[model samples]
Structure formats: structure tokens, C-alpha cells
Target: MISINNLTFNIGARALYDEANWHIKPGEKIGLIGANGTGKTTLLRLIVGDYTPSSGSISKAKDLKIGYLNQDLLSYQSDKSIVRVAMEAFARQNQLHTEIEEILEKLETEYSDELITRLTDRQQEFEQLDGYNIEYRAHEILAGLGFSEEDQKRQLNTFSGGWRMRVMLAKILLQQPDILLLDEPTNHLDLPSIKWLETYLGNFEGAVVIVSHDRWFLDRVIKKTVESRKGKLTPYAGNYTFYLEEKGIRETIQRGEFKNQQAKIKQEERLIERFRAKASKAKMAQSRIKMLEKMDRVDDVDDDNPEVNFSFRFTKQSGRHVVNIEHLNKSYPGVPILHQADGIIEKGDKIALIGANGRGKSTLLKIIAGTETFDGKVEAGHNVTMTFFSQHQLEALTLENTILEELQSFAPTYSETNLRSLLGSFLFTGDDVFKKIKVLSGGEKSRVALAKALTADANFLILDEPTNHLDIQSVNILIQALQQYEGTFIIVSHDRYFLDNIANRIWFIEEQKIKDYPGTYQEYEVWNSKRVIPKPAPIPVKQEEKAKKEEPRPVMQNAAQQLKKLNDELSRTEREVETLEKQVKEIETELADEQVYSEPARLTAANKRYQEAKAALDLAQQRWEELAAGIMEIEEK
Candidate 1:
């Protein structure tokens, strides 16, 4: 589709791409990843002709269609509805349809071979443009991005900037260009929206180039990767996970080459020194000097190590249960974010908390970590040391302290030089160590916050969406390092791929509640899939003597059939009750339990027996419902 031959671009003295030769097939889904300021964005801009390269050329086929969504993508006015803005992408296709209709109308009155052929050609074009499904597709994209039917009719100007970005993404997805380019597309998306995008891009017919900080998103949507580093764009086969292992292999080869070249340089240096003192080899020295001067120097090959991978070796171990929360209730001004949320994290547990945005995911983390106040109970394990990383953690950094000094304070046992070396693992090296905390960018500040929290001697790590703003490389580094970590972790993240690789259990937060799932992330997904219709096949009850004698397995079959029938009814009743509850909440005022006008003893007794006799699967599903409720209450609070 698009190709770059000998591409080179520079910012001041730093070269982003130096004579880099790279090409992407027409339908390839490629991820552009690298360290900060490595020119990933610049390379993307060059592809879209937004910026000119310093040298070399970028070639593209004529008549090629491209849809690029940059960080500064245009947004609709707040006053405009979401549907109106998203419909703009289909304008060209709509016009083509109109023209085809006009041609057909003309053909009804007058007929000619030439005119007939032209009409047929226009119809084909309209079909190819998906003119028939344009409106449907537009609505589908908007709805998947979290815009409700009511929201679609609301004025766009009334929405926040984050929501406006969703409108921009919906427009891009609707266009269906030959090549789709997205930068940080998942930043504003909720779980459902992210999943929708993954399924959409995974099957996209056109070429795709996405720049995202979401590790899980890249692993699912991208098929290939083009990474810019050390002044070159290196190509890798497969997705981000594939690039991870492949990049390790490539680094090994480069390291071997670097070593061999260094050995040769050292041998020549020794020879030149020895020859300088000998008159007999003066003629040979001239030849060696010419060889050394003409030799093309090889670039330094850095070590093949993950970034921001600081070790957290605590002096003491935590007790059996690392952290616990009971009946947690929290609320902020204007809305209730959480109501009666509960959770528990034992030693050696790696838990992931996931929900939609503004659903108290971070709030749950803060409450558990004791960084924020709550109404419910929170208990730490015996001798359990805790560390936390919040979105606002950068505010904790001291302006007067250097990077080295900050590390020395918590990990003070290590020498100042050693502390600086640890900071280098997080990309703070040499003069960067001396720079004040206030001088760093948002991403850099986040890295520093993560480094400090993870490096401390703590038995438990409470990380709230730690992967936000981190590139694929940095995210993988943290993923691998965390997998090797010995402490318990309660992580809240939208990156499903990361959770799949590391988390042993799930702490789902939603509504005004928290629920726990005892299994891997994959198992949780399987359980969640079952919850939609609840196909939990109950165990067959024992057969009676008469039934066993008459028809053998009839009793078991009858019980199984009965269970299925009950389950069908249960699902229907549950949906009806849920619908009624929503309607009731909307219409009736929230009254206290005392205002129910019922005897407390009878109500409590009836609910207990009904709940106990329920299926085990439904009982296990309580956590999800509670979490969902917590999410709702948290937002309301």
C-alpha cells in the first residue's frame, strides 16, 4: 500500500529514522512502537504528508485513500449531537448514491447504450462504497463507542473533551478508508468499546497503523510492528507479543556483533601502541593507520533488557492475607462512586480490577491502599508493607530532590551511585537524574512515579491502571517484571492482555460493590460469558429405585430437563426484575429501609431462603453484580 525507501528524519542532533527502508502491505495491521521521543509520531506524520522528511522519500500509490486520526484530531462542537458529527464520514458515499439515483431516474425516460453503461458503472461504485449500509454502520460504530440512543441526539458541544475524542474515532471508523491510522485510540474507550474496536480492527480489510499505549489492544488488533529506535525503523513480524520475543533475539545478534567488533578494535589498539616503540615495524604502522581511519564504526549495541524494571526486594514478608476490605462505601461530591464495596487480597495473589471509565476502579485501589478515606473497613496483613501508585502520584514528588536523592530516601541502604543506576533502568540517566520533578513530561513523570512505588521495599503493590501513557515496549517490560515479582499485587487496568499473562484472580469493581473471582483472567471471561444467559449445567440428581428399575436414566434426565427449564425461567425473571428496578429507580424516590412498611423479620427471612436455594453459579455471580453496583454508585456519588 505504502512504502518508504531510505527514509531519514532528524530533530536537532537526534536522528529518528536514518536511511530506514520499510514497507507495509496493503492490508497489514502494523503497530509503531519505541521509547519516548523516538519519532514514532514523526514517522506517522510523514506517511500522511503532514511533515516533510529531512532526506529520502516516501512513496504511495496514486488514488489511494487514507484516513488519519492524530492526537490533535478535530472535534465536533458541543451543541451538535453525536449522530450528526459521526454521519459526516458518509457524506461522500451518500453523494455517490444520490448521483446514481439521478442517473437511474434519467434512464427511466431516455435510453442509450452509452448512458446505460454509465449508470451501471455508478451503481457498482455505490455498492463498493457500502452506500446501502452507511447509516447502519455509522450508528453501529457510535453505539459501540458508548454513545447511547439518547446521547446520539444530544448536542456534541455539551460533551467533555474525552468524549469528543470518541466522536472523532467513530468518524474515522465509519469512513472505512484504504488505510486507517489511529493514535492512542483506546485512551478514552471503556472495556466494551475497546473490545468492539479490537474485533473491528482485527477483521478490517484495509491496512491499519495504530499508535496505542494499550498493550492488550495492540496484541489483539495489530499483525505486524515497525519500531523506531537508535535512528532506524526496525520491522518485526507478528503482533506486539511476537515483536517482544523477536526483538530479544535481534538484540542478542547485535550484541554478539558489537562484542566481536570491540575485540578487533582492542587488538588494533594494542598493535598500534607496540608498533609505535619499534623502528623495525614503522613501515607496518603506516599501513595499520590507513586501515583504522577507513574502518566504518559500528553503532553501540545496548543491552537487551526490559525498561523501568526496578527490583522490589523487601526485608520482611507479608502474612497470609496481604490486604482486606469489608463493606467499603465511598462517595465524592455530586455522585456516589462506591457503596458497600468489599475485597480481600492475600499473600502471593495477583489480582486485576477492571470496569468502565469513572467506575471507581482507581477509587477502589486508593481505598485498599489506605491513601484515601472510606467508610468501610480496611485491614492490612500482619507485617505487611504496602506501596501505591495513583494517577495523581506525581504530586508526591519533591521539587528540591534529585532523582538519585528520591531513590536514596526509600531505598536508602543502597549507595547514591547505585540509586542513580536504578533510576537509569527507568530512563533517567546522567543529566536526567539532576532534572527537577517539575521539568518532566506527563509520561516521564508517570514513569518516575511507577519506579518509586515499585522499587520500594513493600510486600504489596497497589497499582491503579499503571499501564496508562506507557508505550508497548515499556508496558511489556513492566508486564514481564511484574510476572517475576514476589509480592502481592492488586492492579486495576484495562489492558486485558497484560492481565491474562499476570493476574491469578479478578477483583471486578462495578455498581457500588466489589466481587472476587477465584481463577485466571481467562476463566473469569468464561464465567462472564456464561452469565449472559447462565448456561450453568447443574449436576444430575440421584435416581430413585422405581425410576432406576423402570427406565434407568429417566430420573437423571428428568432432573436435568427440569434444571434447564428452571434456568430459562430464572433468566427471564431476572431480566424482568432488572428492567423493573431500573424503571422504579427512575420514577420513585429512594426511601430508607424503614419506609418499606414491612416487617424486617419477614423480609429478611424470605430473602435468605430464596437466595440459599439458588444455583451455585448464581451464588458465585454475586461478586460481578456487586461490582457492577459499586460502579454505578461510585459514579452517582
Candidate 2:
């Protein structure tokens, strides 16, 4: 457990936090949430002691072990195989096991009672530490992070940057520290892997503090939210969705009170000034002014929720069909990625495509966007304007240009004043406008790419994981803006809450096939529930047919006769319901009697029992109806 007190951090006169306090308790799962550049990540660094606070004290238990996973991963280029590196987390256990082996060998050679006792104690300690299951635990953690069994033997250097980041995550999980601090843990995870991590974190025994932009992931795992914004940290006792609703209600009340106090302050100031100018009332006015000076002013904090304001002024209206794909098949070397795929993008339709990572979701987007080609038909509509943001969309930006210049280059006719205004709306402020794209952070670079994309006025937009680097607050802004945009969109994202709230339809991509559901993602989940059950047969076969043929036989007749035995069971349930209903009616009759009202305790007890009996009767009636309906529906035919 840890607590931060009176933490004030300032760099070059810009204060990130002033007297901010944050607390972490054992076994607590918390989400650090805020808009981009609001100091969420900075607070994480401060907690892990990665960055010392400018002032104030961070009090933590002396022996508390903390594991902090920074965004810029330390490059894991080494001779050790991936499996060995993953197993390194169990180094201490392995060492203890080796010592136990040596002690056993020595015990066999020398007979010393004291030495034997010490070795016995050490063995018990090793067993208590779970030294035996270390390797198995490591393997389980590593595999959950998307590492294939075969890839375990391969060196870590062979993996790409994203895969290496997963390996780093695996290492942190394997460490089994007391407190785990993860920053952008979902950044490198595919959809399946993200879901896996969510379940894993939900059941994690240790305390976890995660900072991520994925709202759906947070909603599933975190039960509490810690919002770091505007030099303050506010803790809410619920998940992401619950926290949003609570924060909205709280801000509305706070803003209202703040406005009223401000108006009162102004009125008091005017009256005090007017009375001070009058000659005779000077003494009373001076006392009132002193009271005003001593009174605390309620500082007004607005509902500073970020707005998206997507102004995509298109150059021309797209054709009816924005894109069409037919019999698309592609392969590289020996593996077939997409097989005989067909899809279409209609004008003004917002479509969401979801699939696992490393699959052909991005590849399909490329084929449709014409950034890459396929073996089959991919047609772009006539006179259609198109803009695409790839998963690695930042690669498209011209790093040499300033943020303002970047937007201006796309829309040359627009003045610098208008360009700055546009950039400012996306959180690119005065000094940020002058910074070259080369020096911008990943989130900043994304804003730059987004600004240029909107300025082009493309009627069709293809966004691949656009919420990757954004925070929760910024993501909502993007969602509102996209919802208001008047154009067709084909987006691929793993954020289920976002898809549920914004997408009109979902295209579930799996097994080289796409299933289109004409509803929100939440509805899709409900529809998926039916697909889980085995469908009922049109008619009973096998045993029923054999029974039908042998109906006249005595043995078949015997089976039918046995049905009369179960009739007693059905009758018993029906009778139970009738008995309970009679009991409720008796209770009502007793309540109508004057003597029953004289005993308050008896009346209360009878009412409780009556309620219970009524519930039992309702359930028994439902069950009886279901059994009777099934028997009648099958036999009446």
C-alpha cells in the first residue's frame, strides 16, 4: 500500500500536479484515466518512484515491491531463448532448488544432526515458495501473452517490436510483485489476447493499477477508477461506465454551486463598493468588506469534457457503392490469409470490422483501401473521395512539417489562423503548433494525422484502431465527432464499449469469413448467445422411432406404464403450488381479522412467510406449465 501527500510537480512554470493525493490499497484494482497530456502517465511514474516528485512525500511500505512497465520497452536483444528469458523470473526459486539439491547430496555423505535439521528447514521453505511449480507458472503466463509453444524455443531477437513488448509484459506478470503498474498494456495485444489479459487481470491476486485507453477492457477488469486531471486525482468506486455516470452527476452539481457562489461574490462586491463610497455608512461597510476578504471563494471548474468536432468537408459525394470486393484471395509464400472473401462498403453506412490480431483484418482493409492489391476484385466507387488511417497510421505523416504546416499543406487555401484553430481543437496548443511532427509524441502524431485526414474532405473513411494512443477522455471526443460526421466509415477496433455505443452494425471477422449483424455490438452479443445452444431437431429420431414401431409390445407398453409413476411427481408439484396459494389466501384472511392486527410481531412474521410461499407457488406453477406444455406438444401430434 502507498499514499502520496501534497505532491506538487512543476517544470518551467507549467504545473502538472499541485498538492495532489492518491492512495493505493492491497488487492485493489484501479484504472488511471484522463485525457491525453493530462498527467495520467506522469502520476504512474511518480508512484513507481521512476520520477521523484517535485515536492511533498510519497509514503510507501518499506518492503513493498513495485513493478512498473514503462511504454518504451527495454530492447530484449540477447542470446537467451524466449523461453529462458521468460523463466528468468523464477531465478530465485531455481537457485533455492539448486541449493536444496546440493544439501541433499551433502546429507548423504556426512551424518550431522544439526546440518540435517537446517537442510530440512530449507526444503520446507522451498516447498512453501512454490519452487516446484515455477516452470509451469512461467509457461502459463508466457503463453497467455500470445507466445506460441514452438516460438518459446526461438530467440527473443527474432520477434518484431510489438511481439517483444508482449514478451516484456509476460516478464512483468511472471515476476509476481506485490503491486503491478501497467501503462498501455493493451497497446500490443490483439483482440483475443486483450480479452485473455482482461480475464487474467480480473482474477489477479495482487494489486493492479492499469493505464489504458481501451474502455471495454477497463470495464471488464477494473472495479475502481482513479482520474488524474487538472492537477488533481479523484477516485470513484466503480467501473468505467459507472464512473462516467457518477462523474457526470457530480460535475453538474459542482458546476451549479460554483456558478451561484460566483454570482453571490459579485453582488456582495458591488454592494460593498457602493456603501464604502457613502459618507455615513463607512464604518459598517468597512466591516462587511473585511468579512468578504476572509470568506473563501468557490473556484469554478467547468465540465471540461473534450469535444471531437469532426468537420470533414467532403469535395464530392461518393457513388452509391463506396467499395466492392468480390472473391478476394491472397497468399504469401505458403500461407493463405484471406480466402474467397467478398464485402461491400455502402455510402453513409458506418461499419465496424472486428477480428483477432495477426489475422487479415488490416490486410482486408488494405485491399479495400487500395493501399495494397489482392488476387480478386476490389473496386473503388466512381468519383469517391477516400481517406485511410492505418493501424500504424503515424507513418504517413511528413515529419519535417510543423503541426500547423501539416494541416495547411493538406488544405492550402486555409489561412494559418484557421489551421491553428483546427489544431487547437484537437489539443494542439500555441507552443505545440510550432513543434515539428518529428518531435511529437505518439498521441500527438496521431492528432496530426487525424487533422490532415479530416481536412481532405473525404466522404469515406477507413480507420484501423484509431483509438490506440488516445486516453479514455479523448476517445469519447472522437466517438462523438464520428457519430456526428456525415459519411461512410469502415473501422476496425477492439474496444467493445466503443463499438457498442457508436457502431450501427458489426462485421465479425473470423475463420476467413465475415458475419454481418445489423445491430449494435451489445445486441450482437445477445444474438451470439443463441448460437451457443445446440439447435432442436425437427423431429425426434432413433429411440423414438424404435418406440413407435414396438408400441404394441408388452415391453414398450411397460415403458408407457412407467410414465404413470412420474405422473405422481407432476401431480405433487401442482399440489404444492395449490397448497402455497391456499396459505397466502389464509394469511390474507387472518389479516382481515381484528385479532391478527393486535400482535405486530405475529403479523410481520406471517407476512414474511406469506411472501415466501407466494414466490414458491409462482416458481412451481411455471415449472408445471413447462412440463405439461412439453408433454402435450409432443403427445398431441
List TM-score per model, in order.
Answer: 0.70, 0.77
Error of 2 at 455 (Å): 1.7
CA lDDT of each prediction against the hidden true structure: 0.71, 0.74
User: Candidate 2, residues 1-637: lDDT per residue as tens digits?
Assistant: 8999999988669889999998899989999888777787888888877788889989998899887787777465766767677777776777776776675555555645665566557656766877655655666676777665555666776666666777778878888888889998888777668877998888888899988888888889898999888898899999988998998898778788889988887887888888888899888788878888898876676656746544557768888998888888874443345678777878877888876555567777787788776688888887788888864678978899888878887888777876776676677778889899999887789877876776776888888887776666566767887888788888888887777767887886544555588888888877865442211111111111221111111222332443463466679888888898898799878866666544444544554565466556665776677567645543443
- Cα RMSD to native, each candidate? 16.5, 18.0
**Model 1: worst 10 consecutive residues (lDDT sum):** 541-550
Candidate 1 global CA lDDT score? 0.71
Cα lDDT, model 1, residue 2: 88
lDDT of 1 by residue, 76-163 (tens): 4646677778878888776776776575555555655676567558656866876655655666677777765555776676565666
**Superposed Cα RMSD, model 2:** 18.0
Best by lDDT: 2
